[model samples]
Target chain A: MFFIKKNWLTGYITIVVKGAHPELFFQILAKHQIMSWNIIKHDKETACGRIKLADVMKVRQIRRKTRYKLSFGSRKGLPFTMKQLNQKRPLIIGFLVVIIFIFMLSNLIWRVDITGLDAEIEEKVSQQLEEYGVKTGNFQWNVTSPGNIQKQLLADIPELLWVGVKRTGSAYHLEGVEKTIVEKEEPTPPGHLVATKEGVVANLFISKGQPMVQTNDVVYPGDILVSGFLHSSDEEDTNSGTIVGAEGEVFAEVWYKSEVTVPMEQELQLMKGINEKKHYLQFKDIVLPIWNFKQPSFSEYQIESEEKDFYFLKWKLPVTYTKKTIYQTEITKQQMEAEQARKIALAQARRELSRTTPPKTKIIDEKVLHESAENGKVKLTLYYSVLENIATKQPISQGD
Target chain B: MKKNKLKESIMRSITQIFDLPSEVTLKLPRITTIGTIHAYIENHQGLIIFSSEELLLKVHQGHVRIKGKGFVLKMMIAQDILLEGEISGIYYEK
Candidate 1:
């Protein structure tokens, strides 16, 4: 009878019997090893009982041996429940579709809100976000994290002083501060314009000061090129002088010496614009290559891989989608002559010197002081003359 | 018939001496009743008749008739019958 309890999973059927002796039919069923329970007699000729669904066929076979009429009343259990569910296929499919729809909706970016920025900058940020796959209706997993987006935004948009990116549910909120340029105000105190570096004055413009040095005059650091004191030549007394702030430009020629070394042999790797893409799905530490299983036919290549994580609502899934781009590279080795190497070294030294100088400075002259080729390398020591503004404000002491 | 009776008596005596159950030794039906509401019969041969008010089952050498109100067979198997109702009486007929 323990198997009878297990029969509930297979199923059970209530049977109704109508005959002169329905109970006799059940007794005969019991004798035939077809078990039944809960036998209720409705009248003198009708009776009903429950039998395992498996015994229905045997019951039908035995029914022919007697004049009793047997009919299945109701079927119940897991098998019948499954059959009923199968009958309503559309309903179940609709339920599954609704669940899938909600899941997709939860993982999509619903809105992108940019605040605290001008319309121009906001439009630029929006365009940049679209380029990064952060626009609305896009899958959230396809976009980088908010911190990464903030870093990329700040790097790409120089006008953005500070930008804050926050992801709340399915919406992206960005707050940015624009860089404001402030104008500098001059000092009201009476000051002299002194030479900041040792140079020969190439040009001089005195806007509000008396010129103390002429063109072509060599001046040392801290030497006053323009004085704030105005002394009238007719007045022999220098004690009564008008003191004012000096405003002028003193252009002078400055000199720089730099040394550079260039190797006679150079090897460079250049991309040939030929690339292949491979895609992979990563679960934990396991990487499953999904697309482009064949390796690219390239001797020298570089691989650039980008990984995007999946998220369910606010939780990050362990699975990640990775895209790898393999670019073929060509390496070329160049053997240069000693003269060519020396020339390259001189140009490199001049370029280095100019980079370290002021923005408005001009290179007036350059000369190779020394050049030598040794140990497969060319070394050059070069001198450069640059014309630049040398006047620096120095406040005067009124007590003196 | 006389020899069968003598064998039955001998077996009954032997069961009594050994302190054994008669239902197991003599192949007799064992009927258990819970108050006046339910009756459970084991080692029964067959069901003679059954209705809402009465049930008759073939036991060892006789028929056991159960007269009750609203009699329902709670379970029916090869060797056991569980009857549920208001049991008014139980009679054995040879």
Candidate 2:
């Protein structure tokens, strides 16, 4: 198309000339309708305007038989001049080449795609995406939501600690870190009130086991909550001489301490905007992407994206296109004063001590110890050695 | 004086080309072995219902017609198929 439109105009309508004589010659040609005059200039070296055939440049023309012409005249002055640019070459050719390259390179994918998997117990992380809308030959958001699908899959299977879904063109990638759940040990057989914490009995409640402490008694950590219901000493059976133990509850004093630390810098998102572009490629599969072209952000910001195909065209292509947001954010760092830090530290200590201490454990006293402050950061240490009478009891299944 | 065989042949040829709606009854083979999106209709009929597979149904003035995934009329021969008021037990009548 370009060759057809612009090539002829360059070939016949214009020509380059030099000097007053050649200029007059081109003017004659123009008058005779043999040439349409385009460019006439004075400065022979640097180009001022379009060069016509009359413009002077070192060239040669074949006349009669042997043409030994060499002088600055025009392209006609050159010995054997193939088609060469006059002067507007850079502007015309540069625009054409740049436009062509940009258009062609745009077809290449900048992202990959993966989405659509629905399974109960099975981790169809890859297969489900391939089933609904995840494959090569799709644009961003052409298949599945890369980031959201990754997070959802990870969340659904709590055993998965991490999942990374990325798009590299049409193909969607799914990398995951499966979570490992550790099992806990079972409780000891009941009947004996074993000590869970060592304590001077601050309080006591005996339901099935012996009461080892009284109220106002202090207790150490890991004293028994209650003795084991069955005593190893009482191994013998009934009448034959067996020492049988009774079942009950025992409340003892339990003590606990905790340490807390909060960093001065915290990142949080304040605002965000969304823009999405949809692309469909390949003969079959689709690649969908929701990308964010935005400013850089702090390390603490989290991003989310999603895509769902309503119906498929040709039984394979997605009929519906989805838009998502790739997010970039700046995390605002927070600075905390000494007062807030102290309060936060104390709260942390209380929560930790409360969880480990048995129920009904009272907080006797709490002391706040302010540590050294350095570089806009202050540490608050809470020496909360609490005195509480706690009863630790866990049910254990007896052998039938 | 007219040729009856030629008339039959012409009618059959016309049926094959314009009879795309009939081909809509034939079942589409499973798309993938993994997921449940097993079938898709090649020739689309206006009315479509979905359960396990898809069925193309057509309702006209007096006669009603149903085509499977490809084009089989096994149960449409005997009874009067009432598409409006939910009538069942139909066989290939036409």
User: Evaluated with lDDT, which candidate comes out highest?
Assistant: 1
Compute the interface RMSD for candidate 1. 0.7
Query: Can you give the TM-score per candidate against the true fold?
Result: 0.57, 0.34
Global CA lDDT of candidate 1, please? 0.91
Clashes of 1: 0
Can you write out model 2's per-residue Cα lDDT over A1-400, one digit (the tens) per residue?
3432342344322233433233333223322333222322333321111223432221123211222222333333232233444456787789999866654343333334332323332345544544545544333344445666666666656655776777543345666655556685543344434455665564455545544445655555555445443334465642333222434444443444445676555555654453233333223355533344443343434444343443222132334444434354556666777677666667777877789765656677676655656655556566554455445554444445
lDDT of 2 at A62: 24
Two-chain DockQ for each candidate model? 0.60, 0.00
* TM-scores of chain A across candidates: 0.67, 0.39
lDDT of each: 0.91, 0.41
Screening candidate 1 with a backbone cut-off below 3 angstroms (N, C-alpha, C), the clashing residue pairs are none
User: Where does the lowest 10-residue lDDT sum fall in candidate 2 chain A?
Assistant: A58-67
For model 1 the TM-score comes to 0.57
Off by over 4 Å in 1: A1-92, A120-134, A140-169, A175-181, A184-191, A206-211, A227-245, A394-400, B1-94
